[model samples]
Target: MKACDVCGKKSIIQKSGAHRYGGGWAMRATKKRKVWEPNLHSVKVTHDGVRKTMRLCTKCLRRVKAEMAKKVAKKVEKPAKGLHFCFNKSIQFF
Candidate 1:
C-alpha cells in the first residue's frame, strides 16, 4: 500500500459496472470492485538545508514547485538595501 508522503493520499475502492453492448435487455448488469490509486511520484527535495526523498502526489508536487518558484522570484525582485523606491505621487504641503 504505497501512499504520498506529503499529503498521505492512498488508494480507494469503488464499485463499477460491466460493459454492455448493443441491446442487451435480457443480460444482467454485473458490478465489480475497482481500486483507484493516487498518482504518486518520487521526488527529491531540499528543506532546512537537508535533502530528502519523498513520494508526492501530483497536486502536492505542483504546490511545492510553485512555492519554491515564488521564493526565487521574490528574492530576485528585492531591491538593494541602500536604494529607495518612490512611487509617483502629487506634492502635498501641510
Candidate 2:
C-alpha cells in the first residue's frame, strides 16, 4: 500500500518467465509471479513556507533537488538592486 506522494507510484505484480538450461540452451520455460515495489523514502518538503513530510520516490526526489538547485542558481545569478549599470545618452536638438 506504500506509494509515492509526488507521482503516485505504487507496487505492482509482475509476471516473469524462467528458462531451464539443459545443454547450453533453454529447455523449459516457467512462469513466475513477483512483486515490483517502488523505492520510497520519507522526506520533508516545504511548499509555500509550509513544511510537511511526504513519501517520495527516488526519481521524484532527484527532480525536486534539481529544481531547488536551479532556483538557487537563478537567485545567485541575479544582479543586486541599485548595483546595475546603465548607459546614458544625450540628444541634440536639430
Candidate 3:
C-alpha cells in the first residue's frame, strides 16, 4: 500500500471521479462520448534529502501550500541580530 509522505497515513479510501488538468493536450467529448477519470494533482514533495514528485489529492496539496507559506512568512518577519553591533560600532567610531 502507498503511504502519504507528509502525514505517513495510508490512503483511507480509493479516490474516484473525473479529473481535468491544464498545460497539456485536452480531449473533450459531447453527449456521444463519456470519459471517467480520477482526481489527482501534481505535488512537489521533499523527502529523504531529495525532492521527488507524486500525485496527490487537491485538499492535501492545498494544506501543504498553506503551511509552507506560513513558515516562510514567519522566517521573513523575524529580523537578524547583527545590526545592533554594527550600529554601535559605527556610532563610537564617528
Error of 1 at 48 (Å): 1.8
Best by lDDT: 2
Task: Give a tens-digit lDDT track for model 1, residues 42-64.
Answer: 99999899999999999999999
The candidate that achieves the highest TM-score relative to the unseen native structure = 1
Each prediction's Cα lDDT score?
Answer: 0.83, 0.83, 0.59
Worst 10 residues of 1 by lDDT: 85-94
Cα shift from native, residue 43, model 1 (Å): 0.5
lDDT of 3 by residue, 1-94 (tens): 5555455445444333333672243343222333333445668788688998976666677788899999899888664544444644662222
Off-target runs (Cα >4 Å) in candidate 2 are 16-32, 78-94
* Preferred candidate (TM-score higher): 1 or 3: 1
- Our tally of clashes for model 1 stands at 0
Question: To one decimal, what is the Cα RMSD in angstroms of model 2 from the true structure?
Answer: 7.2
Candidate 3: residue pairs that collide: none
Ranking by lDDT: 2, 1, 3
Backbone clash numbers for all candidates listed: 0, 0, 0
Q: Candidate 1: list runs displaced more than 4 Å.
A: 17-31, 78-94
